[model samples]
Target: MKKTRYYPFERNRYFYGKLLTVRDFESEQKYFNDKRRLMNRLLHGTGVITGLQVIAVDDKSVSVEMGAAIDALGREIIIPSPVTLKLSMMQGFSNNEYAKNVYLCLAYDEKGKEPVHSVANAAVRSDEISEYNRMLESYKLFIREEAPDPSVFPIESIIEQTSVLYQDGHIRILQRTPRYVNPGQLFDVTFVIEKTLQAAKISFEFELVGQQLQAEHDAKVTFNEPQERQETEYEVTVKLRADSSSRGKATVGIRQDHAVLRIGDKQVSLSSARANEVMIMAGAVDKQWVDDFVNRSLEDSLDSPSDPCIYLARISLLQMGPTYMIEKVDQVPFNEYVYNASALHKLKSKDSSAPATPFSGSITARSSLRKIAGNQEPELNVTFNKDKGELNFDLGLPEVQSGDQVRTGVVEIPIASLNKFAASPFGRGGKSYVSAEIEHGLGRGSLFIYTGIEEINEDYISDILSSSERLYSGSTDVFKGSEHEPSGPDVKIGTVLYPQKGTFRIGVRLQQPTEATQINIRWWAFKKATESGAGSDDTVDISSLEAASGREEQA
Candidate 1:
């Protein structure tokens, strides 16, 4: 498979299977401008210091000696010129993009990009400007003296290695390189030695960290501890002690130790770095309002002479955050909420041009309960009719405000509620859910909470299964069954059933559960089987069929 590389703004370019560097900071041009000239610079103009030695340091000047690259005439030469060094301690930029670009170029490229605006330019006071200029004037000079032979220089063998000396016996050697560097691009790093230490042969190792490096093709790093070798990527740091240290006098070799920063495998971009979860809560829709619009005198066409055959609802959602959860549902359960509220409302207002429903419900906290504190019963009511859809109730407690970090229950209403409402002889298959509006006298505010189909269904199933006490006695048993298996009567008062065509009110009250508890009423939806035998078809079956193996009904 081809590896996909991604650069946020610019397109990724592959040359000789390596990333190309933008070398010229003077003209501010990128790599694609002139590849051949840049290649020439890489072969000849580019030079590495085989060794580095800090001869001496005065108040103003730091004298250093280094090995040079060979010239085009096949003659080894020493370059004595001012090595312009830019210290970007904390450069100012318009945004992260500019900062990132400068950082990438300066840290990885031999010739780093220059800042468009100086830190001094953004300085508010006079001292800031003066300090910046003073630092700018402290550029070190690089003098290239023509020597007879390269072997004449003793420091030529010692590369640009920085040796740090501390006051104590401990020594810390540090080398820093850009975290990422393209091939053929020079990696500039600063190495510091904390204290003075004597070692004949010093070797260092470096590699990319984390999962970025693939295991199969990764290189192994061998450390020779006896030879006083320590390693760090781009940079290496060695710790030192306090007494009798010479850290300040340590010199750093910048070039000879460089190597090609390689990766085991090319990295592929991720589809997404992060995922988001959203929630939404909506008020109940009004059916009466839609009916009234249909009945309006101005437009006879607006009225539906007959019920629509196929209703395609287009519901516009109203929510605050990405996700809205129904907190509290009033006197009506979630099934009722949807049966009376959502479905009917949707049926009447299928068109976008339809007028707003007369009834709508909102979520509100109980006034008696303190925000974030438990032990309060929240309520919701639907009072709005064709003209209005609001129910105002007070817990007779203090007023509350939004963002109180209060914990509220999730009110679930099921789509089955809509089915149940449709089954009702009195109901026109219209909305059946209740809307509760909380109104406080002084310190509290009102919020709207709505139940969705899922919540309603879940709550309905939970209520039916958990209900311990029997409600009204309805049917009577017509016949009895065999005694061996103890078959129950078909019709009887208090006979548990999966209703086929009936309307019954369900109430929910949270109660503690105990083990070995069984029920006479069994309500289970059908599910599909998978390889692991796991999946739900969500088919509602109401029959007196035998239970599945290992799933027996309990009294």
Candidate 2:
């Protein structure tokens, strides 16, 4: 009725005259033992650390191999020798349920007696008063209707789980899984499972998507060979119970004696009376979980901290009245459970592929500086929506691997530079100039961003981004080509007076100056195009103005 927590090292100090009693010794032992228990629980979580194999002895019984395990309270239980047990006698057994699945659990217990200090060994009556009967720790084997949760049970180390169904045994399965992740990257794999049997057909399908990820295996293991029984085939569809701990990546393991006919599309494995023990683990680099399996043991399946206690295997039987027989046993290996996106993505439905996007496009133009050969504009792969004024452009960069996330260089459009080069129809102030840095290569129009396609995989995203874009135009001079005659450093195209139908010449007469001659030039253009004047690129007669001998001759 009372609960007491042991505070270690509170034992009494021995003095020369003080009497040492059995209680003192018991206290010392409890301290050390409690300390060890704490260490065990902290260091090793519950489950078989090594050497516990549950072998099927028959329909009603199974054998347990020697092993060691830590319970929830950190108690270490070591089975010194292999022992056989009957399943029907263990707790939670019943003949009533037609389909009964009972997990054989190994639990911890305490037994051997300690001293009854207050009374003699011979107490006349059955109910005898005593000081105490301390007990020695021991272990027990029991059965649970469902797998034990680590939170509620001191133990829950399972030797094996058995179903009382009548299996015709013709169906066997094997599965394989990827071993190690690429750390920062992932890879694709061609998954394959081999089968052996006469005239049997099988198909496989799986889906591991969203927050709740599980591999639902459906298989039709049938018997083509004629048999006395009425039912020749049975469907073994293993629907795993979902766990919140693991999401995208899933790893499953099984016991050594039981050859797991993989719970999936019709498939199977290695042909032997007894295939290799199911010790398939997930941990290799080329791929893990396999090559390391030989060196590993299913006996140690519960040792690792990274993975979980996964569903191993299950079997279904026909009608329970005892007329059918278990057929043949086939074994198969599981494909490794992958954690990286590269592999998990493959598990998606074929239709799950992403829609076409610009980022996925191939780079059509090389990164260059020279005038695009032949003055041909680079196919910017851009579409401008007139109604929305949105412009979409594809940079044409190559697709990147899942791990290679550096989408660094982008086709950038410098609006500032574009505005600077925006020119009017007439040239009066200066010439239009464009720099190659902002005008060449992928920068043709310079209108995009590049942070790597970490979120989406598209060569360009402008189809949506360009919808809100607007075009800017610079101011223009309406009188750029006036009709007045003018003289200037340069003339506008139409501002020059040219004869429409015939070639014409102009004559310029000048005086031979006695001093240095200077002629001033002007725009001569109130309206130069209409006022025909001595023009540039023109044929003209040249004559010098002669000095007059007297004013009368000049008149």
Candidate 3:
């Protein structure tokens, strides 16, 4: 380790000296150069004189405004106030170079308690001191020439001060309190203003326009004020109509008008104009029923064999509007029922060894009215001719009793008549039906034949039963033979015995009934199995069987 030589005034010390000879010049030049470097480092590192602006300078002091900068450890170092420097210390320094540049830095260090000046008590040099004075004057002139005009600074300063001025008066529609409302319901509308005015009257006009109804109304309110800068709110209440004629979406609005404001004795007219439309729905309709009716009507039109009456009724409803006559029959439930007919032919078995032979069966049908009123009986002329395969029902006006409110009667035919008709040749083995028209004083009526089944037994008889009785009455058919009798083998048997049941229904609909009434007619039949023949194999030998046997023989 080498010995460390230290200068007595090296640390936190500065000096001002003159070059006496060539030999002493080196030490003095190195001393001043190190001092200059240290000063520059402190000025840049601590940011003390980096942005210093000279406010006023004199022999005693220099005024400056500057920001603090951080040291290496991030501690803030503030520039000392009232920076001052001794004029005699800056001797022989170049006026254009080091003197002008280091002037502010020297002033900053001089003001601090730290010993940053070089010539602690060195005697002053008169001529060099005068040169420093001339440099300082030159600096002052340069600063004045480079600085912007003082007038430009006042503009930015004024903008900042005026940015916080109070705002002028304005009115706003705060809210349409109840945007949606029902008929006859009251709704509130609110308005707000930044400041209140004396004798300020706000006028409002409300109008309702729709396909079914139209109405208009107006209201006004005046305000009393001490004219304070505060938020003010006003509310108005309006009501809708309470009637069926108000049914539909109606346009409701608040119309604007010129408002009058009084300032002392002078009247001022202000346009408080606002035009906004609010929609309000009123009245009530059975939307669910209409939707269901339209769906059912469209389905009826798309039916494979469409009903003409249903199609025509749908078109009429569309033209007349679904609401037409819907309120009258919305809650009414239509009546419907079914009647079935079948024939069973019993075959005789010889000596219980040979199988029973198959027999021919027939079915026929007709529909008619059933009943009229609950208690009051009406004269019904019904005719069922099995030979002619015809059935008719005529309903006559009932004799009015003492307590009767209206004349009403129900005409209906028996289910047995339909079974007899179905057993005829005309109704056998096919869908056959007959409808009848009935005239009554209260409502027009029509009878519909809803035939379920018409079948014959081409096999051995097993049992005979009614299909409607088995369905509606829950009655099962009973055979006289053994219950354990096998139906048949999986493979086709020569003779198979089984019982088959069928149902036929007849429905009579009466519109505009004067009283609560019901008409029900149902019939059922069963065709017993008869052994027709052996279940022969459908495949045949191609060589033995001819494609056209009749024409082949002629060929």
Instruction: List TM-score per model, in order.
Output: 0.13, 0.31, 0.17
What is the C-alpha local distance difference test score of each model? 0.24, 0.34, 0.27
lDDT of 1 at 458: 32
Model 3 weakest 10-residue run by lDDT: 308-317
Q: Please give, for residues 247-287, the per-residue lDDT of candidate 2 as tens digits.
A: 23434333223332332344343233221111222222322
Q: lDDT of candidate 3?
A: 0.27
* Tens digit of per-residue lDDT, candidate 1, span 258-323: 322211122122222111111111212234234433454423222221211110111111122442
Candidate 1 lDDT at 429 equals 27
lDDT of 3 by residue, 172-240 (tens): 232232323344332333333222322233333333222222331234433444233222334433323
Quote the lDDT for 474 in model 1: 25
The CA-based lDDT of model 1 is what?
0.24
Show model 2 residue runs off by greater than 4 Å. 1-12, 19-23, 113-134, 149-184, 187-319, 322-555
> Which structure among the candidates has the greatest lDDT?
2
Clashes of each: 84, 54, 31
